[model samples]
Target: MDHLYAMSLDLNALLRDWPFEPGMLKVRKVTGVDGREKLQMRIDLGVLQMELTGRPDGMRPHGCESLLSYHQNRAALAKAAGNEYELSAEECSELQQEGIQYYHRYVSLFQLNDYAGVIRDTQRNLDLFSFVDEHSQREEFVWNFQQFRPYVLMMNTRAKASLLLNDGKFAEAMREIESGRDAIVEFFQKSNFPELVSKSSEIAFLDEWLEEVSEKRPRSKLEIMQREMESAIAKELYERAAELRDAIKMLKASK
Candidate 1:
């Protein structure tokens, strides 16, 4: 906890000042397996520009960091309460000092056989951290976040389409969906967790629920309508999943 207060006070100052280029630019790089060329990107941020002129590979621990960073203030809390390691019933106050606080707190929790406490602490900071902390939350977020760190990378046009659909920009969204199939699929394959190719239960329960969408749908027209809805949702999913497949191909080819 030494200089804990000073650490927060100097985060920005500690953050090295890096330069950026106009418009969307790239500033992250990775060397080829043979070590000849490097992979890169070009994108705009909320407020910042970057160019990957000649970058070096730095180990990015996005897998572990995202979860830890989300509940980081917890570490600061334990610190402020004084280094009390006695494992009686007590709530750790989340204070803020360094990002490392999150790392230490969880590390200790794991060592101290605090399974329930670990899950509780993680759930408590679910939304605040990033993912919802549900099943596969770590797998889902780790892969997603790792795919686009240092440079906030985006490898597929379907990602663009997802944004468009989200923003009510149907035309653009559909456009990418239609044309970017290969790119999307390729992106998925390159991802750390490729099985996300089939996204898990978000709103897909209709397929399962409909096996018996209530015994009430015994009528002719109701059954037909339910069947059609199932077909349409499935079609939409097929198209989306196909895009990821192509993205995977492209990524592997690039490698």
Candidate 2:
């Protein structure tokens, strides 16, 4: 056997040290041999490695940052030349394959709590979907990628809301979640799939998450006092309600 080939084929020690868990997303960041940071995901068979940025596989298709960027530039040049451009079936397939590379990296990034990276990659995929939808030569090609749009939108929303949540802005996070849900609904409606509004798993996940976050959110002192004042007024306790109202006024004035 060739020595270099044998060495390249061996991964027994690496696999032994990091056993894969069936249902867990095992990911870690490490410096590559070339001294750049990279991500690794443990699978049942072995580990899959990805670059930290710029086209997860580190390939610049057609000398562009990504296939989508290359195609977009092509479309722009075509328009400038007074000619309409459309993607061939082969081009659409190639773009979809490139998208999978991004999908893997973003999913791993999300697990590693790198929400910004997740947002970046997911948004890129969404752009790819839109570009393909508008320029693909066939409706079937458009649907092939459009079907995953809701799930991508959901992940993008979660990442955005999570960044706000990390900054201790629960109200802002809730608003972001609501906006994200509305976007998904709009997508369904635009796709003429209004009946899917109630059955969408992405919407369901956000709904449940919104409830969970709302329940766990901390109430401000003003909110507590206002609630108490409302209760007092409802019970006809004029004196108590008047005292609470005075405190609320002072609180609002202080702010």
TM-score of each: 0.18, 0.88
**Candidate 1, 174-199: lDDT as tens digits:** 55444444333455567565675466
Clashes of each: 21, 0
After superposition, the stretches of candidate 2 with alpha carbons farther than 4 Å from their true spots are 1-5, 226-255
Candidate 2 per-residue C-alpha lDDT over 1-255 given as tens digits, one digit per residue, 9 for 90 to 100: 599899988999889999899999899999999999999999998998999899988899889999999999999999999998899999999999999999999999999989999999999999999999889768899998999999999999999999999999999999999999999999999896789999999999999999998977898999999989999999999999999999999999999
Q: Highest TM-score, which number?
A: 2
Which parts of model 1 have CA positions greater than 4 angstroms off?
1-20, 32-255
Give the CA lDDT, 0 to 100, for residue 56 in model 1. 18
Candidate 2's error at 160, in angstroms? 0.9
**lDDT, residue 79, candidate 2:** 94
Global Cα lDDT for candidate 1: 0.37
